[model samples]
Target: MHKTKISVDNIVDNQTFIPNYPIKMSIRDVDFFYGSQQALYNIHLDIIENQVTALIGPSGCGKSTFLRTLNRMNDTIPGTSLTGTIQLEGVDIYNDFSDTSMLRTKIGMVFQKSNPFPKSIFENVAYGLKVNGIKDKAIIAEAVEETLQKAYLWDEVKDKLDKSAFLLSGGQQQRLCIARALAIQPEVILMDEPASALDPISTSKIEDLIAELKKNYTIIIVTHNMQQAARVSDTTAFFYEGVIIETGDTKKIFTKPIKQKTEDYITGRFG
Candidate 1:
């Protein structure tokens, strides 16, 4: 495992390996509303490049809502609005970036449930490249193999490229969706409880794949499993009632949380 010294801006000098990578996404004063209901409140978070940042809390605490705001995924819902700025590479996504398609390509998403397209394994991975206007068959084919290898799914499904994606096991389907996301060569990957439905062995595989992926792609994951967050993330944020209670290094957040609320929640107390 490699470690980067913590940046002076983070103010956590106690941790040995708090990432000093540049901020990949900067979210500030973000509030999200669905019609008359408010889901997130004045949220501020910085996602480090090439590191995993986990959003962990009980259900309906705005963890997923905050994750969607990173790539403007929440804009799809009707009667929803957001206030405040979310910047990717210093450009405000909500106010300045109008091209959602290109934004999505740079920041891809994987949902809690595996949502593989109704196509063959090869086509599933090739779909994004084709949609983005890559017409050359050789190029798409090469990209598919490289992406599947990145998602750690190539060797397992290499010989069955023609098989329908639905024929795969649940874990394989999730990995396939991840491969599909990677096929576009996104800069950041947002995962909403990606391994929540998997068995322990499958969950371990996903965790390992995440570890490997963070070497190049910045990752922001929303997970309810504290143990999973502790195991995979470089940083962790605890949300409660739509507000972030604590955010910092994963080890400190789990072992010596500065806030009592964070400690109580992680200790299996009332959420």
Candidate 2:
């Protein structure tokens, strides 16, 4: 990982987050269920435009479940349901946008493991463009290259656009997946432990990419790595047993948390 000092001056952090910053998305009184089991409690959160907000907690704390709710990924699961409202820039995702495909285009997701199509690297990124109805070959080609560059993978994979995505290393495959998500020009990127499966160097590159991407896209990341959250997120929300324990500046959450559970979890006392 890139060695960088963590101090107030080194961060653009939550304290400096203007109260007037536009809200990119909102989650209000959200409750989630998987069959008979309740997952998320009355969850309320705001995702700011051009900022990285990280969700952190121990295993099965519903951080990942809540991240999926933003883009309605849970809809695929049988007997799953969500209550209350989730809005993207004041538009109710459930009511205003019945076109789930468009919603997904606006908010793309990267999973825990890198998932590439059984095709060439170029085709992997081009797949999203094709799905979005871009038929022009020039446009698709330009987008594939541009997205790969934005993902910081163009240099490594540029010579092998025709090569199979499966042939790439795990880290490269993850970046390819990120490039695939970027090809759609999504406004928000939801990452669930995106760097967890990678080596340290690759993980650092992904973190650096996250920092750059947040200048154009709102990023919500779910991470079990507290250090990664501290480095990449402007604000951090700590979740426990499906409820938010505390949400605040990354500095405060790590250095001086308001809640005991938040402190304990961050200090390695308990989950």
Candidate 3:
């Protein structure tokens, strides 16, 4: 693996990355409400290109709610509405010109549970490509192989491509879902408690995979596990009661948080 030294000064002096490295997504004064109750306050944050950002907070803190908003997943819920702007590559995703399907293709998502289709492993990974109208079998096969390799699951299931995806272990299934997401060539990957359902070993594998994936894809993970957030994220944002309380370097958030609420929560004093 190739390693690069990223200057901390660059991260501190500018919330944005250097020139030639434009941000992939930006959220400006975004608020979300379900019917009459607001789930997220006026939240403003920027997602840097090709970096891992973690959302950590107690349950009902709106971490997951905030994640879903990025890809317009919240639109599926009736009576739920959004106020303010969420931009992908400088264009508002909520605008009239925005295509929800195309936006979803650009911004893929992985849920907490490994919900693979009840189909062959090959078919599961190729489903997205097929939906996108890539009819050539060779093209689909090549994409499936490349995506699986990128997801770190090719070696395990390469020989059994025709086997049912359900036959794979929990960890393998999660990686397969990741492969499925990558098959569409997404720019950002949103994960909502993706490892909570897996065993310790499986969770460790997923964490390691996320660390590796940051090189090629922007990742935002919502995790209740402080240690997992610290292990996998470069920046950590602490949310509470539908607001972002604090966000900074992961080390600082864990060891020396500036806010009382952040400190209390990290120290296990309260939710």
Local distance difference test scores for all models: 0.88, 0.88, 0.87
Distance (Å) between predicted and true CA of 85, model 3?
0.7
Between candidates 1 and 3, the one scoring higher on TM-score is: 1
Clashing pairs in 2: none
Query: Candidate 1 residues 249-271, lDDT tens each?
Result: 89889999977888999998975
Global CA lDDT of candidate 2, please? 0.88
Off by over 4 Å in 2: 1-18
Q: Per-residue lDDT of 63-121 in model 3, one digit per residue for the tens?
A: 99999999999989999999889998888999943578888999999999999999999
Rank by lDDT, highest first: 2, 1, 3
Name the weakest run of 10 consecutive residues (lDDT summed) in model 2.
1-10
Q: Could you give the candidate ranking by TM-score, starting with the highest?
A: 2, 1, 3
In order, what is each prediction's RMSD in angstroms? 6.0, 7.1, 7.1
Poorest 10 consecutive residues by lDDT, candidate 1: 1-10
Among all candidates shown, the one with the greatest lDDT: 2
